[model samples]
Target: MPSGGSTLNAENSGNHTLPSTLAGVDPLSQFLTGPRAQAAFTLRVTMDPPFAIDVQDQAALTVIAAIQGGAWIIAAGTDPQFLAAGQAATVRGPAPYVVADAPDRAATVVIGPGQSCRTPAGDHVDVTMSHGVRSWGNSPDGDTVLLIGTYQSSAAAGQLAVSALPPLAVFDTQETDPALLGLIEREMSRPAPGQESALDRALDLLLLHLVRASVDRADAAGPSWATGTRDPVVARALEVLHAEPASAWTVAELAKRAHVSRATMASRFQAAVGQPPMTYLAAWRLALAADRLASSTATTAAIAQDVGYSSAFAFSAAFSRAYGVSPTGYRRAAEVS
Candidate 1:
């Protein structure tokens, strides 16, 4: 709850407070927090009709909101999903996709890795198409206007949450908050101090809302962990795990804390979350460790202990097995990137 980025260790863990990153968070919020943005790329695009942009940037996540007109999201082997005015959609990536005025429109600009823009023949158009501050398009007053925010792979924290998304998830007008979308659009147009941080927080909120909507929709396809929060027992168990990940948690302890029999807890957790309680906790701990390794200067041993590993050797073995790289090696590679 502190303004500064201070972490509360196990001694203070009993207070049920945690670092800013994981304090009093829900299951979805804990995972969604992984995509925290830093100087994220935010853009407003105004395009004429019959326009298509071939996106191959391989961003971890992209949020596209239709401000004025609409666009069609065309992914390979899936029906095109349209975002009418006031609607938004999130696209998970590394895979290529297209946003077009119509499904059949040919792409005139190709968005390559690093957010580089070029024609299909590779003629650079990044600067040529710039409309204004954080804006891009073929025309300054194009009929169709869209607000876009992207989280590049390196900046993303929650690998587990990102991995669980469908390639493209659309949120209709009823599912989105117009005020938040307006805030993002307005913020994108302004050049001010701390604007990047402002936009980043707004984008995080947008993603959070979208993911929450997905979970609430019974017919919508969402991660099992997100849907599991609907169950009181599982939600309580998840709250304990997230709030005090460094605790020496056992299934029996979690069951006891949730006021349920161990068997009931285990079976219900598996049924709702698709993983046993202990198994999920292990993955969750490792995920927290991985995020810390990339974002902090903490020693591996410290991070291991913070994530509930008994020893550095044990943490290293488990981390290596899960990530295919030792902690030091992973840290080194993260630095290079």
Candidate 2:
């Protein structure tokens, strides 16, 4: 195996132990409940000079973080973007792109399904370049090093978490999630029990970090979901809604809690969150419902009650309208796909 390289599998990595204190954390608990980051395809690539790889797998999401040296990324329809050490970039995919020593360098290898690789001349290079586990590269000591993680099957909630954002976004050096990075690095090579589970969880946290950072930037490119948090009134309202999605909340009630008049709250919420307060609440409830449906085997009626629907039929209708599929159908599709 190449140094600092390992393929992580949930079954092979062993059972992970979690602290009792972290049991009910909303988003984190939801992420741990299902297929959010279960089978992450991760790799550490080490390369020397004149190296470039074209990624064609087009996974749902691809995250590239620099570890050792700087690299250039040529995203589709975009100019080359340089990633210095300690910086990271996320590419929303199904689109092919190139990562190389320099933006001008052509791809010498193509990464395909199952992470198999082949040269331009149709020569198989998987075994020749395979370092160990999930590691693949030209040399273990190459100056340019990167940690790549791909989410092949994104969970419903995970999708909702990153609903806003363009195809390609980069996190500046200052925004790097160092805590999660350190945990991943520490567990990357441990051949002990539950290492795979630990790695998967770490990777999930890393993805969450990237997604939140993308939204938090709130620039011309930032998503409204993130920018909404910038408004104190809207942020407080959001916290209330997220904390009690099952509550029958009205705009007047939400406004009362936000300490703003109904009219002012409505106007500010619409301005900041890009939607009326009630509309955002409805969407948030549905998003929570989707997460439950995808991650749990609860009855539709039970799930409906948890998300504030009076009847299963009502919940089903709303879910269908929002996701284009019934609760049961969505669950089945999430499992199979």
Model 2 agreement with the true structure over 221-305: per-residue lDDT tens digits: 5435456778899888877765666666777988899999999888888988788777776776676667777767879987776
Tens-digit per-residue lDDT, 184-302, candidate 1:
98887777888878988888888878877877878655436776788999988988877787776778998999999999899889988888877777777777777778788989987
What TM-score would each prediction reach against the true structure?
0.88, 0.82
TM-score of 2: 0.82
Candidate maximizing TM-score: 1
In order, what lDDT does every prediction score? 0.77, 0.70
Q: Global CA lDDT of candidate 2, please?
A: 0.70
Worst 10 residues of 2 by lDDT: 6-15
- Backbone clash pairs for candidate 2 read 1-131, 1-132, 2-131, 7-134, 13-194, 14-194
